[model samples]
Target: MPFSFPTGAARFVAATACALALTSLVGCSNGEGGGGDSTTESATSPSKSGGTQVTINDFKFQPASLTVSPGAKVTVVNNDTTTHTLTASKGGSFDTGDIDPGKSATFTAPSKPGDFPYTCTIHPLMKGTLTVE
Candidate 1:
């Protein structure tokens, strides 16, 4: 004898499972995780050492532009499926070689106030700006 779900229960269960799986995938796909809009800003509190965080999600940096105090430590977190790099556009200053998915890297902000632009060496089109105050 074989057992099975009642009526359309099996179909409903399968559909629900697929929906859930897609939901999870969507979050990693663009880093918004249902948060909506890739351009939205995501702020992080400064740590004891005056460190702050920037999230790399869905191929775009959350809070694409960040302003922090001089000498503050900025942590870059990769929440996407692929590896990413946060390299200074002009070289030197700070660079996170390669950050794997779900991984993170840290760098110190310039001690002087200025605008520092960065991009993913792997994905040149992915860009961000850091403002040191």
Candidate 2:
């Protein structure tokens, strides 16, 4: 092969670019921690008319159950050390992506007038539910 070598400066630039790309990819996880393999369905804003806040900390969900009016807004606050996602189960009315520690995720759902179970996609043991009337 012809004489070809990366100078120290060139190598540094290439390494920096690679590091940046990897960091970006690592931050794109759906709702899971590490890599870009997010397993949560992602949260969506509901067309409802109410508001509630759920805090995630101490490896548990605060106020595991909530009762709100039809068409309400729910805000999920993540205060844990790891990433956590707020996802609705069957007939789910909301889904929130990875909420980093000390961060929050908000989701608005249309008035459904019923009960909806939710949980953290990253930690299945952390679960909760919402009841709308």
Candidate 3:
């Protein structure tokens, strides 16, 4: 038997396809850092037990971008010569305040997944982002 085409069904199918595409792009994995050495902010899923390392160097984030499961905990290690911070953007996932050089900060990833762009309070130009899966 052939499937009958309904007027609304086509729209629903199109919408579903679009949603899948968006989701795939949003959470596409590229290791701990999604930006891949772009000096941007990033998010990453902790090892089931939680806590992933993010290296801060040259006044910039090593991975620059990342994707992690919601509610995962992450740790940002300051490996540079300056202080840095990870301030959550709008989703209220996690934030690190004033991490000194050679130090590390930790935060819990938000339960809800979303795009979070953050910057260091001490330095506005220093920015990074996180894509919660």
**Maximum-lDDT candidate:** 1
Clashing pairs in 3: 40-64, 41-64, 41-65, 41-128, 41-129, 42-65, 42-66, 43-66
Q: lDDT at 97 for candidate 3?
A: 83
CA lDDT, every model vs. true structure: 0.78, 0.70, 0.68
Give the local distance difference test score of model 2. 0.70
For model 1, the stretches where C-alpha displacement exceeds 4 angstroms are 1-50
Q: After superposing candidate 2 on the true structure, give the runs of residues whose Cα lies further than 4 Å from its correct spot.
A: 1-50
Ranking by TM-score: 1, 3, 2
Q: Per-residue lDDT tens digits of candidate 1, residues 50-121?
A: 578888877888767888888888888899767999888985778999999999999888898898888888
Clash number for each model:
1, 11, 8
Q: What tens digits encode model 3's per-residue C-alpha lDDT throughout 1-133? A: 9976556878799888888677445432223353455433444635334466667776666567778778767788888655778787665557888898889888877777787776676756666677778
Cα lDDT tens digits, model 2, 80-127, are 667888888775568898899899888875476887888787778676
How far does residue 51 in candidate 1 sit from its true spot (Å)? 2.0
Give the number of the best model, judged by TM-score: 1
- Give TM per candidate: 0.65, 0.60, 0.61
Query: Between candidates 2 and 3, which one is better according to lDDT?
Result: 2
* Prediction RMSDs, each to the true structure: 6.8, 10.4, 17.5
